[model samples]
Target: MESNEPLYVIPERYRKIENLHIVFWLLKDLCWVMLWRPLGLVMIVPTIGAAALITWQTRHIKSELLHNIAVFFWIIANAYWMITEFFTTDDSLRYYAVIPFSIGIVAIAYYYIGLRFAIKK
Candidate 1:
């Protein structure tokens, strides 16, 4: 059977959904970076290390569910640090909060790009 057809046609609904997803992801990243950048640089090492560990583990586990679980914990840790910093007026609390927030940013990126793509596939 030989068929002649339109080469490129996207359904309106799918296009809208995809566009919304892209916008949401971008907004999420922007918020995280804006809110966390100061702390992010300070904790870069651990953030990178955690991400590397997640990437290596995902290869062996091959489970989206597990990856999602890791991502959840990463987000929580980050949020906790942020909350702690916001509530505490003490100067000493500043340094301790950076690690969690930085790692959280890395985890957010990983999930937004990697895990989300994997699940879609």
Candidate 2:
């Protein structure tokens, strides 16, 4: 990663919007890991919304498409987990959800690393 580069280059006009996308990205993770346990189902609303905004902002960057896809999948997994919490009385099921959930985080990490290299180009 470029030490000076905090973000991938975007048109000056879209810089703020792009930054919002990053905030939403982090917020989605925050909402899931922390907020969902306390606030319950409402967390998915912003989680999906952030993922949508992220996809929209990064759509033109071909290198990010896969990363975005991984993110969406991860978000879906989280949504599934949240929904299960409501409908299932089984506590052990969440243990199983950890597999996909962990994969999503790994995918997001790959996206970040890929973005760093993509910007280097």
What TM-score does structure 2 among the candidates reach? 0.50
- Tens-digit lDDT string for candidate 1 (99-120): 6555656656677787879899
Tally clashing residue pairs in candidate 2: 0
Backbone clash pairs for candidate 2 read: none
- Candidate 1: regions farther than 4 A off: 1-62, 90-121
TM-score of every model versus the real structure? 0.31, 0.50
The CA lDDT of each predicted structure is 0.52, 0.66
Best by TM-score: 2
Query: What local lDDT does model 2 show for residue 22?
Result: 61
CA error at residue 50 for candidate 2, angstroms: 1.6
Tens digit per residue, CA lDDT, model 2, 1-121: 4487576666764566556656654665565566455444565666677666766777887556557766767777767776667678898876776776677667776667866678779
Top candidate when judged by lDDT against the true structure:
2
Location of the lowest summed lDDT over 10 successive residues in candidate 2: 35-44
